[model samples]
Target: MIAASVGSILRSFVDGVIVLNDRHEIIWHDLSEEISLAAKAGLPISELIPSAGRLDFSRYRAHSTVNGVPKYVNYSTFPIQRDGETIAVFSLSTNESKLKDWLHQTIEIKRQALEKEKNQRNERNGTTFSFPDIKGKSLAIKGLIKEAQAIALHNADVLIVGETGTGKELFAQSMHNHSPRAKSPFVAINCAAIPENLLESTLFGTVKGAFTGATDQIGLFEYAKDGTLFLDEINSMPMTLQSKLMRVLQERLVRRVGSNEVTPVECTVISASNEDPEKLIEEGKMRLDLFYRIAHTSIYIPPLRERKEDIRFFTDYFLAYYSKKFSKYVPPFSEELLEVFLAYPWPGNTRELEHLIENVVIRASETDEAIEVDHLPAYMRRKIFADPGYRAIEQKQKETKKRPLTSIFSASHVHYIQQTLEETGWNISKTAKKLGITRQSLQYHIKKHGLGKRD
Candidate 1:
């Protein structure tokens, strides 16, 4: 009676169960009515489990067609022994649909857990990028990087001026990382993204009963303590608030809304704007006194179009980056396409270039030979074919070949190398050192780009 009850309970839980003898033949089975395997004695186990072996089984899943219509099986197996001697095997199967749902749920739960952990880590770090993250190799960029490094040493408030998408925020983060306050909090807020009134409170903190829904809080100035506070799009700040902000910078103290007590502030201020301070001053968008207080040290990040070498460098850089990201093979941009990149004014700067490369990589196929103009999107095609430089290259090939990787010094190899040679008085060793290449390699590039006058 107990053995019968055990068998009935097993049938209730599992979809099917089979007993195979030591010879691996199915001797008996209590199959579910939903699974029409046609139970029989002495059928070879391999007939049902084609991959059957004597190894321990897992929750194996596979499709079967012997039941007239195709169906999936969730299978598990183990040796069933008698008195320490192997006699038969027990094969258990559950509903495949139920098992698959369970696996998906398990995977999703793990993914969410990992995502939460990553967010916590990022929050503690305060910022995600540094000086090395800004990829560029042009005189403009190199000189700016050196200047910014020098500025990072001091505690004076700084203003970074550049066109939109020139990575103003990246420079802000890098400066914070290189400064003496590297370990401290790095707080950043976009002045333009929030309302004028809210931005004031957000920067200066709030005090309870100051306004409806206001509460006591530590503002960015107090919270940043011995760290860095980045205010992006500072030009968008209101004229009235600019004076209040100037006083805070001068006094190095912050008074929360509706609070009579003043709190001393210790964080370094790094402000950025898409427009020049001088221009904003002329437009009455910024106060004159505020300018000198904030612009003690000004850093100008050159646009991508102004430094064509950086453009070429980032093209290859981002191409390699996205190729690894998506695990797809995409050849570098065609020479004509590259020339187009150099000539076209990238208003959006490096960010735009990185995004374009990612888009191209996603659309790349195994059959694509290289990244030709045809590979570019429809809107980009209209812009490229219209450019005179691109059309000239289309007419016939050009002599300006791209230098090897690490050719940052020679943006356009022939012209820039000639200029560098003249500037360095044709000193091969010094030029090579400056360009981060060996003297022998520099000589090869000099020959390849046909700067034979120096040789």
Candidate 2:
């Protein structure tokens, strides 16, 4: 009765059960009724469990052909002993589908956790660039960088004005790195790159059901909370969107599209314009009030042409960087190539120069030992030879090389400014007009030459 009751209890489990004699023959079995039973008694255990003969009676997952269809199973074995001596072996098996489901769920959860950690680290770093990466030693560039560094310590908004390819984004990133909120997010977006229809929601975010297929999303401003938000090509933004952005800056709050609820955000807003803000406002492409609100602490980065003294530095820096990147030898720049590079009016600025070097390095053969004029891009070659402006500038630079030392030149320039100031009785406006220059330019020269003192 006790053995029958025990057998009945074991049979109630969903898993399959089998009892085998010492000869590995089936003594009793309780399994799915769909299995064959033509020779149940004394049948070899391997006939039912094909892998059983090789098993070490350990717990493991296996597969078998049930009713001629493959099925998965988890099997465990136990010895049914009699009076402390081994008698028969009992095997228990369950379907393996449940175990597989648990494993998959565990992997998915771990993946999501890792992804969240990575995102958090990225948000904290914000940007990978700094002031050291700007790569120029020209006086103009030095002055600009110094001003940017000083301004970064402040909490006010900034406006960076420069021409295209002047690296406005680089300056913006450096400012973020120096700022108090360096550990927070630094999100940047180009106003002109995105379609106008989607620009508003992209900057200010959207709520669920705001439009067809719209889902709740956080805007760049929210993402940059307690950090910096860099707006590149701000002048390219639609005037309507500019007005909305102006409101956000003034109120320090944002309202999602299709919703009136306001959420506060603390961020240092830095906007950039490739065009002159005054010109953009004059052309009605940008708002005057918006410019004032954002340009509280403005920094103007001079174009590469104005800082031509740094060309050599930038060329060597880019050559070494790209040569290593392309696995090409760092060859010397030919004298003719250097002349061409200087003579050509680089309208695209430093970015153009860097790309040109990358191209030259990629095209250079293993036999080449130096970069010659022929290695230059065709457009650059044409500009160097065909453009009259380029030729004239080159000729003038060559003529200027015959002049006295830089010290004597500065002395003469100072005397000329001082004489002019004396003649005009130190009236800055009249002296500047008589000298055929802008008041600001004359003032700069006066400051440079220390000729601003009264007579």
Which candidate has the top score in TM-score? 1
Candidate 1 regions with alpha-carbon error over 4 angstroms: 1-44, 47-121, 385-455
List lDDT for all candidates, in order: 0.79, 0.78
Q: lDDT tens digits, residues 82-165, model 2?
A: 787666777776666555668889999999999888777676766867899887879999888889999999999999998888
| Residue range 102-216, candidate 1, lDDT tens digits | 8889999999999887786466648888899877989899889889999999998999999999999999999988888888889999999999889889889999999999999
Off by over 4 Å in 2: 1-121, 366-369, 393-455
Error of 1 at 238 (Å): 1.4
Tell me the TM-score of each prediction against the true structure: 0.65, 0.60
Q: What would the TM-score be for candidate 2 when compared with the true structure?
A: 0.60
